[model samples]
Target: MTQLKNLLGFLWYVAHKFQRDRCMQSASSLTTTTLFALVPLVTISINLFSLFPEFVKVSQAVRNFLLANMLPDSASRIIGVYMNQFSSHASQLTYAGLALLVITVFSLVITVDHTFNAIWGTAPRRSWPSRLLIYAVLILVGPLLLGLGLWGTSLVVSTSMGWAGEGAQATHSALKVLSLLILASGLALAYYKVPGRPVKGRHALLGGALAALVFELMKNGFTLFITHFSTYTLVYGAFAAFPIFLLWIHLS
Candidate 1:
């Protein structure tokens, strides 16, 4: 009983610490920067995937998985239309335009760096060259790694379905679990690396686990709220994406 009480007290303290870190403020700042950066980021990502013929299918699969996980079914269609519209024009942008796009993407990266620094109470940020190099690696390498992982997972699911016949549902459940674990791992890495300071692996992992759990709850809770109680849909209609996106980010 005493151990249980101690654990509960510790959890409450961590929760309070997270609140004190001003998560809403950071999340709002990210949301704003991300909105500006979204077009360029998606454009660049799709362009990169287009370079490899094998990645085409994987990219689409990964995209579908993300949309399904991130938004409710009704909201997904609306968001998809907007994404398609932007992507149609992405290829026509000039080199100068693309450069600006890269800058906007980097702006979001810098914001993330600052937010992590604040969370960890770190100081003396990395120099510009080092920062740019690290951000470049994250921008270029991160998606490819994620794509490969999704491709491999899809392949396994498909193979399992062929052999077991009744494993499709089970495979889906397994994939959801895998996705949570991956999210946690990625968050752990970010918590460890983004502050530009040494962070304990255990501390990073704990933060990651907490973030992953909150993320899952956020998705489900948002979907439920939007489906049942959202006035944004009725009031904003096609513009519903704006408020929905903001609300989601604020909650993050």
Candidate 2:
């Protein structure tokens, strides 16, 4: 237990220090890494389009809001193309998706490796055999982990919906609450999983919860911003808005 505590402490230390450099070095790497890392996430996006109009609606609202508020005057032309990346759902994980995933993971791994290198203040060096082993693990394990997570999330929702009584119906009303947790969990995992580090479970959970909280708050805040503050002219301007959103995420 003590050892676990120490490990958690160390993870927190690295993450805490990360916040300082996030907008500077770490965030920059993370932003680049995440764009690549998350291309795979879009594989699910296509299926999602058929199932959830609500999600696309909310996402567009967010996009429209951000485009208006944050982007500058010069970037308006590229808004349609840029927003497409966020909204895109290809029919299959074509060569392009696979290519994007490969590049993304490669970039993500390198960023993490450097982040760990900085954190431990050690030379960013590894034996080729060891490096290959790690690479093998990531390739094999990453898909399994992601699939497992999706399955687990599905089970949770299933179990909750199984409740049949009147009191349980009230509990059913809180399905979104479960979604809240899952979203946060996703964020924490993203934080833990993105970098080169092998984060402990406790630290991963903690970080995920925090990330989720921040994301939720931003969701509502951004929602409010869109509904009240955003206008047609400002919303359509892509150049100014996209970078600001990227910058904000980098900070996160």
Candidate 3:
């Protein structure tokens, strides 16, 4: 009971800090930046994987996993189609065009970095050259690691299903758990690394787990609201997904 009280107190304190930091406003700005950068970022990741023929399946699996876990069914379908089309065109860009693509993507990252530092009440700790190097390395390496992880996960799931003769439902449940864990880990990494000051790992993990839980609940609630309420669909018709996606990004 004492531990529970302490946990609640800590969470309340964090909530107040987030409010004071204007995180909602930050999220809104991030949503706008993300909307502009989404295609360029996806194009870069896709192009990176395209250099290696063997990882083609891995890239496809990663895309499917993201769509399945991150967005609602209808929104995911619409966005996936548009994203693929945009990325295809983006991949054909010339040197100058590709530089612009990188810049667009970098702008989003810089926004996130600034927001994080503001929340932490710290100035930027890294020089521009160092930051650029870090960003370039992340862009080059992050997707490769993610693809390998997902590929390994798929192999493990297949082996597990084969051994146990589990049905599709079990596989899906496993994937859902995997997605949650991955989200939590990513959040924790961000919380730990983005801040200029040192943060305790356990505290960061706690915050990440809490945030991930809230995010999962928000996703389900939002999906339910969209499923039951046809107001957006009625108003926007076929273009409802864009607004819904924007709303989700802001809320997230």
Q: What are the lDDT scores of the predictions, listed in order?
A: 0.78, 0.54, 0.83
Per-residue alpha-carbon lDDT of candidate 2 for residues 1-252, written as tens digits (9 for 90 to 100): 999999999999878876755536766777777655643433332234324653444334333333433232223224445446544644446797667666665666666667755654455356656765776565554444433444444445556564556435644444346545656665566555544446687887887887667765765665456456656437557554655545455745
Candidate 3, position 181, lDDT:
89
Candidate 2: regions farther than 4 A off: 1-23, 40-101, 116-208, 231-241
TM-score of each: 0.87, 0.48, 0.90
135-221 per-residue lDDT for model 3 (tens digits): 887777777777677777767777766555574556677778888988899899989988899989999999899988998898898
How do the residues 1-252 of candidate 1 rate in per-residue lDDT, one tens digit apiece? 999999999999989997999887788899899778865665476567767898887677556666676555655665577678777887788999888888999998889888888887877467889889988887777777776787788678767674665566766776788788878998999988778578899999998999898888888888888888877778998788777776765665
Model 2 TM-score (2 dp): 0.48
Clashing pairs in 2: 68-234, 71-240, 71-241, 72-240, 75-239, 112-196, 188-208
Q: How many residue pairs clash in each candidate at the backbone level?
A: 0, 7, 0
lDDT of 1 at 160: 64
RMSD of 2: 9.4
Clashes of 1: 0
Worst 10 residues of 3 by lDDT: 162-171
